[model samples]
Target: MKKISSKMIFGILTGIILGITMAAYAVSVPSEQVLYSNSATSETTVNGALTELLNLSQECKSRCPEGYTCTEKKLCKRASTSTLHTETCMTGSACHVQNNYKTYGHGDTITYGNISTTAGTLKAGDAFDCDVNGNGHYESDSERFYYVSTMNNGHMRADSNIAVLAYAKTSNTYRLSSGHISYNNYGNTSYGPQYALNELYNTTQWKNAPEIRSGHITDSSGNILKLNFSYSGYASRLLTYQEVSAGCSIPAQVVSYNSVGVMDSGGPLSYSCNFLLEDSNYSNSSNSVYYIWLESGVDGRNDSAFDIDTYSSNVSYDSVTSMNYARPAIEVPLSDIDY
Candidate 1:
């Protein structure tokens, strides 16, 4: 009886050592951690915790909710909410955090929102994609690229309301809707920017243009969700010039009575279009990157137009005729589209 008891104890000890070794190996990779249930407690034994964590990993690829990020495929947290995302987020919208699998070189295909953009190679610093209007599918040109924008997923809406798993800087593009290209500040809305967005959504050179349509998500219940992927130009809804400027990360500047657009409530917001030249998103920081143009002498107000000299780093706003870049706020709701 003593010999049998000894044998049983030996087996248990051996198994315990082996499990600890395996668990250590499992979480050794940097930033990766074993998934633990919110209900897990310290009272749980080490062996029990390890066993549960290991099993749960196999059972679920990720426990992250939509718009939430899965850190190292273990720690799940809410994505950061910039002003742009907060303004555009719908009542029940939950934004997704950028997921750049550290294994970009080897992990499974990268899915930005609902689109499979980087199969493996196309390089990006953070694994974010921007082509949502056309579905980003260009068979003729296999080599695709993305604009590194200041915008994040919180402000992007998926095409046709399909839930996508990613967001890009262009999500701020929808801000164009706040003003009109043809008529600077028409009434209270910017019809010009809105027109451009519509053009992208409706007209396309390709055969199967991406449009708002019904899509499906493969959940455990296999439930089908109506993915209403559309651009909310002011989706961020941050109409105040200060709000937009801060969201765009523009350099601070002086301003007074700089009314650029009208408000939905009647009068134009005081600082709606306080245009500045220095805050463009491109690395070069030139007017070519992106900028906004206010209606010059329409009401005999300050011209507020600007021009950047690439050579001297000088900005001139005297001329009203010069065409300026329009930095609009946009939102993409990636709640639809299949995974």
Candidate 2:
């Protein structure tokens, strides 16, 4: 565990060059380490010394572990790609390359994190693994989610510390009970209307994801939905219109379905965005598709909430008490996710 430095390596190299020069031209010195030949040409001796230096440098570079390059500073880190040969080297000792480098990318599959997932990456529409019940197993249809967007403080590069928004990969039959998220001027609040979805978010969903820290989302009327635990924060909520259409090609079209799972009105709202259309798990069969609830309620409709029909990628609305599904979405730090 000895620390190697650039200055020390430089000093050793200087000594070797001076020793070789004296050994080639000066009177023979009785030293076991120095090899002196009377008939050898100076050019031959110089070439021999250069070959030894090359071997010495290569030996140290070979110790550098994967994902980490031995830097000129002799410090092991994940900053640059330059290797040990870019600088001088030590002859006998191995360069110390620390085992601390790891790479994270937009589509890199990770095994574990503060919240675990079997299939997931850092790209939009990618699988977001979350098991809500602490049962160690996720529902077959609801086992994964789509990463909708990256927040202001998030990133998708190597060694990045960030947070992203995740939406349910499939739909569920969770009902959105009726009422109104009413507020009074006297600081009194009523969660009775949005209570159904709130209960599911705060209690049932994301139960196993403790790393989903508190956050906030805005509504159509400039209202704020805090996902904090202190006041009335939700653990997992629905997506919004702006969120779904951020970098996607969502058209002005609308699609709808009845409570009995029948397409009643509107046409397909086929949308396309980064990797969203590339999800292999997305269903093409109508039987497995359902409407996904969004966080924002209809602009002027108090008893209704916006929803996206999975069958058509179309946006629509439904009564709060209707039997549509709740596709929960959450925000989590990228650092909390392991590579």
Candidate 3:
């Protein structure tokens, strides 16, 4: 009802415009507290996911035991302690023999070949508890062996993944069936060491031991012969000539005699063969003289196989029919040992 005026009209329009502007600003701008709360939730979600991923990566790593190292395959392996090789004389004692002997932190004798002696902790020369004589008793003096080497599962025996090679403390005599035979032929035949060892697997003497894996046999000339067994392989067989004389700088030889039939040469015993020499008391007793068979057969001579002659303390070859010491060697699964 008041008289119309420009100033009044202008004031009324200005107030309405200002009120609308303020309401639009209030709708668009959220409170500082609200903004901070929303931001925190987003950051928390992202950070939590990152933390979980880090935890998973850490859980996947493997921890190796003492005296072992972690291989690139994420498995545990035996670590060599020293370059120096030595033997421990365990004569007339609970442990019959120890080769490549190295004193562990604690002088502990593994009474059984089970999980108690963890495979990772076993170094070369560690005595493994086994039933050697088939007497139904796992005695240290009866059928025990000292570890000679450690290898991957498929390296030696296909079934024995992650295995250790063990050598006998003493020797046992066995006769190779009389014949003019080559290594390849002898290994395939039932009368040879290759098949003879497998036959023992069915007996108490080697019922528990893992069967031998077929391997190559090399002669003194570096010629290779396959031990293609008809069955899985040998159960308890003799050491290879290469393995026995591995440590020798001037390795011994295996040869056929001339028309007159005489050994052509002699050489130093290998570090491994040295162990057998001392344990057998070949140095002290003349009666202890004997020949030990090697897995290798003479390269050029089909009638002969390599042997360790006690008299000369060197490598030699003898007639396949000759009776020789069958020093059993076995590759056992790592899982059989206890930690």
Candidate 4:
């Protein structure tokens, strides 16, 4: 099984320790008028430079970070309002829009990606109806989906990737739903993470999305996204970790769940993990193995492994190994779907 290095494990444990013990939050609102820089609000450059730490609020006067815009005395992602646009094609076509956005927390900050849409067709018995068999579900020529992660609130906007539900096989023994990815680390190392995500990006309906041959995509602003297979990274795959690791600035917050059936915060996490981890029969199929990485480390006091329950919707874990699967996630602007 793929495993992480000992040093990597130590660093992850250290980072989590700092995350919990440090009374000051890296992005929390401050009392003083904090002078901030664009780099300070980065996930990739967690320990990067900042001459002065600025106060985090929507009401700041200065220019906020790249993905984030200043508003209400704090900093939030910029242009996130347009992350997902709904266009009902009254003219008998699939409803689609050109959604261009900087994927938060994956990679660089300036790279603005785009999505292309063609509009949904009329469901009233047209050639390609929403439901040809009359299942009541709109079966347009294609499905509409957000380019970004699932959560609605974060450093950047969610619903950025316009995707459709699809499926693909991993090993000869495993078949999983398309578009499955992990936001956090599995072991101390990425532990063979990128291959599955590469498969999802190349094999699924999102196959046509804007991406370079290097397994990376560039935005309109000329930023080159150089992503990596990372473990022991930050939490919140939606914006912070996914964006930074994917080569952008916007950070995604992980969906939090207080209970198995109850959702406290991260809905997209549940959607992706549940869809992929749960078998076609919904009975936790051992056929499709899943080895996911989590951003949050194990409470050192509890065990030697990390807390990976956040990665799977139905499965809980004290430890895992290589026979399992580790999925990676990335984003492209819905507008860039055509670009």
- Return whichever of 1 and 3 wins on TM-score: 3
The TM-score values for the models, in the order shown, are 0.25, 0.40, 0.47, 0.27
The collision pairs in model 2 are 162-334, 179-193, 180-193
Question: Global lDDT for candidate 4?
Answer: 0.27
Per-residue lDDT tens digits for candidate 4, residues 19-127, read 5447365555342332212322323222322212223222245556444545431111112224322222121221111112112222212111232333431111011
lDDT of 1 by residue, 281-326 (tens): 2222221423333211122222222222211222212233333444
lDDT per residue as tens, model 3, 1-339: 234332243344345446556876667532221211121133233234334334533433445433333342211222222311233333232222123332212223322122214544644445455654445455544454655444321123233243444444434322234211232334331233543342133324466666665554545554554444333534566655555544333344545467786668654453333444433434333234366666666767656677767545566777666555545666666665432
lDDT of each: 0.26, 0.40, 0.44, 0.27
Q: On lDDT, who's better, 1 or 2?
A: 2
**Clashes per candidate (backbone, < 3 Å):** 53, 3, 12, 79
| Candidate 3 TM-score, C-alpha based | 0.47
The alpha-carbon root-mean-square deviation between model 1 and the true structure, to one decimal in Å, is 19.4
lDDT of 1: 0.26
- Report RMSD for candidate 4: 25.2
Please give, for residues 1-339, the per-residue lDDT of candidate 2 as tens digits: 244343243355567668767777867654445432222222234445456546656765657533334632210011111210011212123211111212223233322112213334444444444454557553424444445555431111111243344443323334333222212122211121244344245644455554334333333342443332232345565555555544233533333446775435642332323222122112323233345556554444445555665433455666656555555556555544432
Instruction: Decide which is better by TM-score, 1 or 4.
Output: 4
